[model samples]
Target: MQEIIVSWSRRRADSPKTFTRRWKWTREDRARIEFYRTELAGCISSATFDAMLEGVNSESLLPFIFCYTVRLKDLDLGFVEAGLVARSWFCLGEGFENLRRVLGPGPRDEGFKYIEDEVEGEDTGYNDPDTEPDDIYVQEQFLTKQMPAGAEEEGALWFNVNIGAPGNYLPGLRGVIRLQSRSTIYQFPLTALSGWSAKYIAPLLFLPNLQELEVEGHATIGGLKDQFYYPLSIPLQLYKGLKSKVKRLSLVDGRMRVDDYDALAELTGNLEYLQIYHTYRYEELSPQEYASIASFFRKNNRSTLSLEEICINDIPGTDMVDVN
Candidate 1:
C-alpha cells in the first residue's frame, strides 16, 4: 500500500486561468491513499485540516474524497473510490452524477442500492415536479411525510446547497429542513435569491448544531436590477434560534441593515469569528456606518461572547479587524 498526497489549486501560480492535470508519481503499489490538499494554504490551512480530520463528520469527508478521485483518475484506485462512495451513500444521494461516471458502472452500481432504496421508500414528491406550486401548506405536508424516519440522526452535517432561478426546488429544501434538525448539522451554507427573506432563510436558522454558516446572495428585492433598494422583508427574529451554537458566520454580497448587524450580535453571542464582505446597499459601508457597527460590537460584548476575529472587506472606510 502506498499513500499519495496531491496539492492542487484552481488558481495557477502564473496563469489566471484554472486548469487540471495529472501529477506524476512513481509509486507502483496498487493500493493508494490520496489526499487533496488545497494549494491556497490560507483557505484550508494545516490547522483547519487537523480540526476537520479530528471532528468533522463522515458526510463532510465525501467532498475531499471526491476531489482526490477527480485529480487522480489516471491511477488505479478503484477500491478506495468504491469504499468512499459506499460510505457516503446518504450524502452523495443528491449530487454525485459526475462522480458516479468517474467511478464507472461496477462500483457505482453496487453503491446505487442505498440511494435507490431512499428514492423508492421516501415520498414521491422528491421526484415528481408536477406538485402544486402556490400551495405551500400542502407542500409542507408532503415534505413532512416524504422525509425518512430518523433521518435527523444520519443526514448530512454540512448542508450546502445552491438554488438557481426558474426551477428553485422548494420541496428539496423542505425535505432537508424536516429531516435534519439544528442538532444534526455542523455547517450550513446556502446561496439563493438576492434578499434574505423570511420564507427562504428561516428554515436554515433552525440548525442549532451548526457551528459555521455562509449566506451569499444579493439583498436587493428584485435582484441585481434593484441593487439599491432594500429587501421587502428582513426578519431579525430568525436569528434567535441561531444564537446558541453558531461560532462562525459570514455574510457575502448582500444588502444588510443596521438592524441586521444588531440581530447578528444577538444571534451569536459566543461567535469566535465573523466576516462581512461587500454587504451594503451600494456594496460598501460608509464611514459613519462602520463606526456605528464597531461601536455596536463593543457595546454588545459579553464575557461569554469572546469574538476572536472580524474580517471586513470592500467596505468603503474600514480595514480588516483581527483580534488574537
Candidate 2:
C-alpha cells in the first residue's frame, strides 16, 4: 500500500484533550499513532494549510488527506468542503457526501449518533444546483486581495481556478495548485457562452504548467459551464491550451457518465493518474458503457487515460477484462 501523509486540524490547541475525552480507546490503540491538529500562529486557517503545501519540494509528495468536522446540512459545511479542494487537499468525508447536508441542520456540538443520522438522511443538499458557488468568483477574489499587478508572473499569488468565488487567479499563480469541492448538483449550460468578453475570460485562462487537479462536488457531464465559460458549454474550453499538461486527475462526489468519459478521453491525452469516487452511484455500470470506454483508451494508445492502477469498489466493468 502507498504510505499516505495525514494532516489534521482542530478548532483549538486543546482539541487533543477534547478528542481524548470523547473517545475511550484501548491503550494499545492510543500508543500506535500521533494525531494532532496543526498549530499555525495560534490558529490553523485554510491559508495555513496552503502554506504547508506550497513549501513542499517533492515531485511526488504523498497526497495530503484531511480529517475534520463541520455543521451538517449547513451551508458552511459545503463551503468548507469546497474550500479544502481549492487549497489542494484530499478529503473523504467519513459519511461520504451525505454527511455535509445532514450536519447542516443539526448543531455542531451534537452527539456522534446524531451526526451519523445526518449522514444517513437521503437528502444532504449536495446535488442541488442552486446551492453551488462559482469557482472563478472565489479565485478572482483571492488574487485581487493578495497579489500585486507585476507579481502575477513572479508567482507571488496563488489561487485554484476550480474554487468557489470570483476571478481566475491564474495570472498570479505562484507554483501552487489548490483543490476545492463542487456542489453536488449543478448546471453548466455551454450553450450560454456566446456573449462573454476576454476580460471576463482572461482570469479563468490558467497556466499550462499545473501539476494536479482535485475536483469535488457533482462532476456531472454538463454541469461545469455555469462556473467556467458560463452560457456556453464548450467541452475542453476550460482546459483549452492546458489539456495535455495535467498529470493527475482526482474526481470526488462525482459520476463518470458516458458522455463525460468521451469528453475526458478527448482532452486528457497525457493524463497519468485518474481517480474517481462513488462511481456509478454504487450500481453496476452497463457492459456496453464499460466496453466503449475501454475501447476508447485502446484506440488512443498514447493517451494518458491508460490508468496505472484502477481502484473501484462496487462499479461494474466489461465482460472482457484485459488491463494490458
lDDT of each: 0.33, 0.31
Tell me how many clashing residue pairs each candidate has: 5, 35
lDDT of 1 by residue, 157-270 (tens): 222221111223222222221121111111111212233332223334334334555655424332234333333235444344444355565666545566556554554455
Give lDDT tens digits, candidate 2, residues 45-92. Answer: 344233222221111111121112111111111222222221111112
Q: How displaced is residue 62 in candidate 2, in Å?
A: 25
TM-score of each: 0.35, 0.35
Model 2 root mean square deviation, Cα atoms: 16.8
The all-Cα superposition gives candidate 1 an RMSD in Å to the true structure of 17.2
| Residues forming the 10-long window of minimal summed lDDT in candidate 2 | 68-77
The residue pairs in collision within model 1 are: 182-207, 182-208, 182-209, 194-218, 243-267
Best by lDDT: 1
Sum up the clashes in candidate 2. 35
For model 1, give the 10-residue run with minimal summed lDDT.
Answer: 73-82
